[model samples]
Target chain A: MKKNRLGEFQELVLMTVIVLQDDAYGVEIQRDLEERLKKRLSVGAIQTALKRMVEKGFLTSEFGEATQKRGGKRKRIYSATPYAHQVLREMRDLRAQLWDAMPRLGTSQA
Target chain B: MKKNRLGEFQELVLMTVIVLQDDAYGVEIQRDLEERLKKRLSVGAIQTALKRMVEKGFLTSEFGEATQKRGGKRKRIYSATPYAHQVLREMRDLRAQLWDAMPRLGTSQA
Candidate 1:
């Protein structure tokens, strides 16, 4: 498998997990992504991305404490793995390098 | 087609084209990616990505001046389309926002 490569949606979902920190979970992630992107997202789409990232070792999830408000249902909290953070940093650096290399006209035209 | 979404390899190739500016072409891009990434790349792989991005409208290509070194073969120079630049900026901003929201410890562990 190709390692350290993230699809756009996977990157977005992984970043959201990091943003939400301890509260990162399915419902919350979907809501937050919708709010931040100003676009509607299906729960299934979010779950698919979450599952794929988990398999890629970019994320880890653990069930939260059971809540009485939800009739003993536990939300699975997600967190970014070290690998995910490393990839994100490397990606940012690569883009910065490219941007720095761009000629004045290249950016101006864009 | 998903708009404004770039795969990891596609993103790398697009960035390389921007870095090379007017000089961007298949051979130069492949060489640059290999050097920066410290990984060997096949011409076929690079061509495939270039073709894909061109079809996606993230890139545009034009034939450069025929060179004596190439025996009259014109190198097809690649450039980032405005859409590509826009997508790159959006991706950067999204990542920055997520990184900002991360707790200090989140980055520390990574």
Candidate 2:
């Protein structure tokens, strides 16, 4: 559980990062997740999760080239590592298996 | 999100309950999850999760008839409510959307 666990929020954040791609940064990730999850996410919460994920080898980040758009500040762009992709796939497959194993609703069997 | 949110563990537990049907009790749920997830889970953790889910209206439980098989002790059996099924379906759909939206691996469009 400790080695390869992805929390619900962490999974959602990682998905948002993968979907955002080149524009995967703090503000953009927060916005995308908020829009998709329909929840008001605190920037602090997203940033913390991003930091933890980067440390966990699930994601990698690099500073973009400095631009004059905001006084030459470089944005930290995030990307999902191959490891993250594998874990995500495993989760999806496991979930699918569980769903398939479920009996039809209203059919109770011990 | 607060109104209809399912944590990853909660979702998994709920799915297991549906799959295990009438046999969805504390010990069985824990064993099934540990086997499928390949992680050691504490009895306390599983029980706490079940309690929370019940409070959240995602599950319902009942005490099974006392049996001599377990020294006349009744097991508390859990079942997923309609709301749980709906939330699980929504989560599956949402994950599929994210997976689809992702760019093909190694073909970095960014």
Q: Among these predicted structures, which one has the highest DockQ?
A: 2
Q: What lDDT is reached at residue A29 by model 2?
A: 92
| Model 2, C-alpha of B82: deviation from truth (Å) | 1.4
Q: Provide the lowest-lDDT 10-residue window in model 1 chain B.
A: B101-110
Model 2 alpha-carbon drift over 4 Å, by segment: A1-3, A68-72, A106-110, B1-4, B70-72, B106-110
Instruction: Give lDDT tens digits, candidate 2, residues A2-110.
Output: 4666889899899989888899999889998888777799999999999999888999999988767857578899999999999998998999899889986657743
Give the Å error, residue B32, model 2: 1.4
lDDT string for model 1 (B1-110, tens) is: 55545787888888889888888999989999899888899999889989999988999899989888746688999988888888888877877787787666635564
- Quality of candidate 1's docking, in CAPRI categories? medium
Q: How do the predictions measure up, each by TM-score?
A: 0.85, 0.88
Candidate 1 on A12-102: residue-level lDDT in tens?
A: 8888898888889999999999988889999999999999999889999999987778465799999998888888888778777777776
Candidate 2 lDDT, B27-110, residue by residue in tens = 889999999989899999889889999989999999998777747578999998888888887788888888888887768653
How close to the true structure is residue B86 of candidate 1, measured as C-alpha lDDT?
88
lDDT of 1 at B101: 73
Candidate 1's displacement at residue A49, Å, is 2.1
